[model samples]
Target: MHDSKNALSVQKLIADLAGIVRIMDQKDQQLAPAINAPSQSWLETWMTAFWETLCREWASIDQWRMNKVLLLVRFFIREQFGLALEWAVKQDPKLKDQVARQLRVLEAWPLSPRERRVPDGLRLHVLDVWTEELAGQLSAAQKALDEDAENSDPESKKSILLSLAQEFMEPVRKISREAISKGVKIRAKEAVKLAEEQLSG
Candidate 1:
């Protein structure tokens, strides 16, 4: 178990990381129109360098002894890092397929014996949404989820179904206030009902 001091240090590091991501996002929004390709190219270069350095450092760590850090990093991969990757893909549509594959790889990282448990309901949902967001199509994520559902054991099936509920609970709520397509909204609601019935049984 992590001592409080180590836990605090991790929290501080995560906060700093969060700040960096937000700054990058804000700059992207502010300068995207004026500088266009050059700005995006520069940002992509920086992001690539940062990711490579991070991967190297990650490899050098003794993650088994750092369970708390490992769990936080896995959650970061599922959420913030995935969002950053999705943003990168948005800035370059050609990279969509590549980033999607990488995101899936990161998503699966948490399931390694190092983590000792499946991703919980909320993280599963966030990962699925990022997949959809990156693809600019919910159908892609839904299809993948359906395939997983088909292949999973009954216990894993519950996690898959819970993700469906999460899809509706969060994104659907925001989409409701936006001018989203009717078909997408209907599909999301249906997913929620499907999750409810299956999980209830």
Candidate 2:
């Protein structure tokens, strides 16, 4: 049985690696063959026990095993970064330009600090990639709002804001407090204010 103390750490490591793999598969056309890959139910069942054994004895694990784990983590970090950059390259240039200015701020947003077995450098890299992805999404949204604002008359813009506030209440509220680009945060705050105004008026 895996030691209770280390179980969470092991699970976190697996989750972190799995998340990277998931994103890689999402962004890489080379992995399209996976759609027809054989089912891995048997492998999944076996690996569960294998990981339990590995984590339970990690403290006294041989040097070779430690090196293997370290190398795997490093390899994934490299691949994840390459794939993330490629994905970003295929995105809209206008939105990418907007997100670029705020990418550093987004990457510095605080995440839950936890004690995990994954190397701190790799963990931070993973977080940066995730934050960049979020910035792209937020920038796209802000640009869309800007386009709508330009196209709509004042009264029509109010209607659009009302609809946006109603549809995106939770996300707008969350983004308003996040370390997103000032423009996006301002847009979110405006939506929130509009929502409140309509509620009171």
Candidate 3:
């Protein structure tokens, strides 16, 4: 019975994650032009709203559940980071050059002594979104495992988590890659048009 319940919980978490990804994708589509606007700071505002929406959705889940879901969230963030960068560059070619320079700075960004820290304030906000709502999930999972050692296998749970993470990543990756590809082509066309205008003028 406990095994079945745990499996259901895992499935629910997967569905929830999928829902979050879908909502984010929709929000991105609705806000893409604004997010990509060269003169606006809409991306930061959108990210904050996204994080807040995620917090509201997962706020009730216990820490252990939140911790498990967070693995998938991290995967989502990594993939979205690439997608967001691609879309940003697509919006403004000048930013492509600026990003190249920033990459050098990122490579040498100083780190504090903390073992697992996201030094950037924005990334710290992302981390806080997860930690604030699910801070007790890890401990709860550990306690549950301790209390039911015979029924719970930590290795098996780890395997399940990994499997779910991959499942969550694949669709998002596919959609983001498609969007980025389309954005790149659009930007290329725009660049050609701008060049032609300058040459004719």
Candidate 4:
């Protein structure tokens, strides 16, 4: 009976994650054209009014993307990992100690400070790194989860998930915020550069 319950829980979690991924895919499709649109011509770019409008549009799109990613992270933490950890603790009180230890390790992990300066022209690269890091972590977690499900030990599987959650939750949020902020700064700098070029020309 216990094994059956664990199996069902794992299946449900995987299904939920799959559904979220599908939604994200749809959003990506919707956003891709706008994000990948060609840059404005030099003449249009020189107009201060047009430049300001472009900056706003780009910032809005970037913020929307960041918000979606953050929402997914929050959903994973609250709906999936949080509930699973709570269930595990209720099932085996001894597991709480292990969770605590894992959390301590996570807490000790060095997080890049939120206010760290992002170099000019490197914003997109930094954002890519942040996005890749989160994607890599999620992919690794999913793989580990599949491996854990194959094992006969339900407690061990829950422990592993809990550890993964502890390691990722805060870092994901931090990186998302940093990425969004850097994107905004990049847009501002771009606007200024456009104005400068216009004046120089």
Candidates in order, TM-scores: namely: 0.36, 0.26, 0.29, 0.25
- lDDT tens string, model 4, 1-201? 224332324446546755654453345335545755422322212222322333344444454345443443344333323333433434444334333433333222212323233232233332233333333444444455556645566546546554544444454344434434655445434433433332210
Q: Is candidate 1 or candidate 4 better by lDDT?
A: 1
Candidate 2 lDDT over residue span 1-201, tens digit each: 434454335446656765755543444334334665422322223323433444455577555456556444444434333333333434545323322322322232212123243234333333333333333433444455466645444344334333432432444456566623555455556656655644310
lDDT comparing candidate 2 with the true structure: 0.40
Q: Write the per-residue lDDT of candidate 1 for residues 118-145, one digit (tens) a residue.
A: 3333223333343333223223333444
Question: Model 3 over residues 1-201: C-alpha lDDT tens digits?
Answer: 234356336546556655665565456456645655543323334444545455455546565555555655554454343333333313355444333332322222211112122223322333333222222333343344456657546555434333332332232233223323444334334433433332210
Candidate 1, residue 172: how far the Cα is off, in Å: 24
Error in Å for residue 75 of model 1: 3.6
* Global lDDT scores for all candidate models: 0.42, 0.40, 0.39, 0.39
Which candidate number has the best TM-score? 1
**Residue 111 miss distance in model 2 (angstroms):** 7.9
User: Candidate 4: minimum summed lDDT over ten consecutive residues — where?
Assistant: 41-50
Candidate 1, which segments miss by more than 4 Å at Cα? 1-8, 39-43, 63-65, 81-201
Model 1 residue 42 distance off true place after TM-score fit, in angstroms: 5.7
**How does model 4 fare in lDDT?**
0.39
